[model samples]
Target chain A: QKEVEQDPGPLSVPEGAIVSLNCTYSNSAFQYFMWYRQYSRKGPELLMYTYSSGNKEDGRFTAQVDKSSKYISLFIRDSQPSDSATYLCAMRRSNFGNEKLTFGTGTRLTIIP
Target chain B: EPEVTQTPSHQVTQMGQEVILRCVPISNHLYFYWYRQILGQKVEFLVSFYNNEISEKSEIFDDQFSVERPDGSNFTLKIRSTKLEDSAMYFCASSEVDSLRPGELFFGEGSRLTVL
Candidate 1:
């Protein structure tokens, strides 16, 4: 199984809608989960970050990680046209010297104005 | 407000040619990294550097690939012989801390390489 799996969604939603992006992993050792936003031909920008099995919120974005289920999610409330971009889920193990971040295939999102 | 900066936003070269991509990471950061993403694919890790040495590298970082921190501010990736498969958007990232937190890593806009 792939270490990380995410739906490559070209999911379209209207403005002001609630958007949820999710990813699942096969590695139980992963302890830090992150969400990144990437625009066309641009680099991935960190959106939300979480450590262990818990939730972290920043502005309109929220990140949730469930260690038991090996699942992580990014929730966007009051989505705007500016939020149209690809959402990527990334995670890394807690090993002290291991800095590699395993990433999932990003989901493409388009918010209609 | 410092951000990572990359050079040669886009480059096209023939297969078997050598290519060098350059980056200047955030001044205060100590850990540096190189990552690549093929069209429509996930971003893949290449290597990570700290204290002028490679701390870790992925399997994809083979003999043909090399990284150098030639100066205080510049980190570069060199491909000895590029293949068509080597075409991808290469990103440079830096972090203030090492394994302490991956979330603090800052990424550059990326240097796109097209091997024909």
Candidate 2:
């Protein structure tokens, strides 16, 4: 089974709506979860980060992780046109030396104005 | 507001030829990493470097692939012999602390490699 699974969504939503993105993982060792935003032909930019299970909020973006279910989520409130991009869910173990991130397939989002 | 930077935004190289992608990670960051992404796939880890040595690598990072921190500021990934499957976008990233800390990693714009 793949380590991380995410819906490759070309999800479209109206502006000012609430957008939800989710991911599931098979690895129980993952202790760090993150959300990244990628523009067309650009690199992945860090959006939200959460440690283990719980929630983290940053302005309009919120990230939640549930270790027991191996599920993680990102919620965007008052979504704007500028928020249109591919959202990637990434995670990694708690190793101190080599902490390479494992990423999801990414979901493409579009905010219709 | 420092960020990682990669060279040769896009490169088209002939198969079997050698190619080198360079990156300048954020200053003061001690951990560095290389990741790859195909046209429609997820980002995969290639290798990680720390203290001028390779800390870890993925199975895809075989003998054909090698990483070198040639100097103080430059970290490079060299493909000794390129293959068609090697065509992908390579990203360089760096973080101030390890995963134990809350510090987030910063990524470069990425270098697109096209092997024909």
Candidate 3:
């Protein structure tokens, strides 16, 4: 099984709709979680990240982590057409040099006008 | 803001030829990294560098690959011999500190490598 799993979604929704993107991991050792936004032909840009099992809110985005279940999520409120891009979930253990950070396949989201 | 920058936005090379992809990370950053994304695929970690040494490397970063901090401002990834499967978009990134921010990793626009 892969260390991290995310549904590669071509999820389309109307503007102002609430969007929920999620990721699940099998490793109990993963203590940090992050979400990234990647536009076509561009690099992944960090959206937000949470330290552990908790919720973090930044602007219109919210990141939630449930370490007990090895699950994490990013919620977007009042989604905009500009939000159309690939959402990727990434995480790693506390030790920086022990291993390279792992990433999910990413979910493609498109907000329709 | 100061973001990472990479050279040769697009490169096409013959198989078995040596290729060096270059990057200039954020000037004040303490950590540097290399990542690649094959078309239609997620970005994958290649190697991480800190304090002039490789801190971590992925399995995909094999014997054919090497990294160097040849100058104060530049970090580079060199492939000894190119292979067709080596074609991908190579991105250079850096962080101001040592943490999970490789996610927020200030990435260059990326160099598209085409091996033929």
Q: Which candidate is the best by DockQ?
A: 2
Q: Give the per-residue lDDT of model 1 (tens digit) for A55-83.
A: 88899998988899999999999999999
lDDT of 3: 0.88
Ten-residue segment with the worst summed lDDT in candidate 3 chain A?
Answer: A92-101
Candidates 1 and 3 compared by TM-score, better number = 1
Q: lDDT tens digits, residues A1-113, model 2? A: 89999999889999999999999999898898889999987889888888857888899998999899999999999999999999999988874655789999999999999
Residue pairs with backbone atoms closer than 3 Å in model 1 (clashes)? none
Residue A2 lDDT (model 2): 90
DockQ of 1: 0.59
Q: What TM-score does model 1 achieve against the real structure? A: 0.96
- Chain A TM-score, each candidate: 0.95, 0.96, 0.95
Q: What is the C-alpha lDDT profile of model 3 across B1-116, one tens digit per residue?
A: 77888998999999999999999998988788998988878789999888888988999999999999998998999999999999999999887675545345778889999999
Instruction: State the displacement of the C-alpha of residue A50, model 1, in Å, after optimal TM-score superposition.
Output: 0.5
Q: Which stretches in model 2 have alpha-carbon errors above 4 Å? A: B98-103
lDDT per residue, candidate 3, A3-105, as tens digits?
9999998899999999999999999888878898989878788889788578999999999999988999999999999999999998888645434568898
- Predicted structure 2: clash tally: 0
* B1-116: candidate 2 lDDT, tens digit per residue: 78899999999999999999999999888899999999899999999889988988999999999999988999999999999999999999988764445436788999999999
Higher-DockQ candidate of 1 and 2: 2
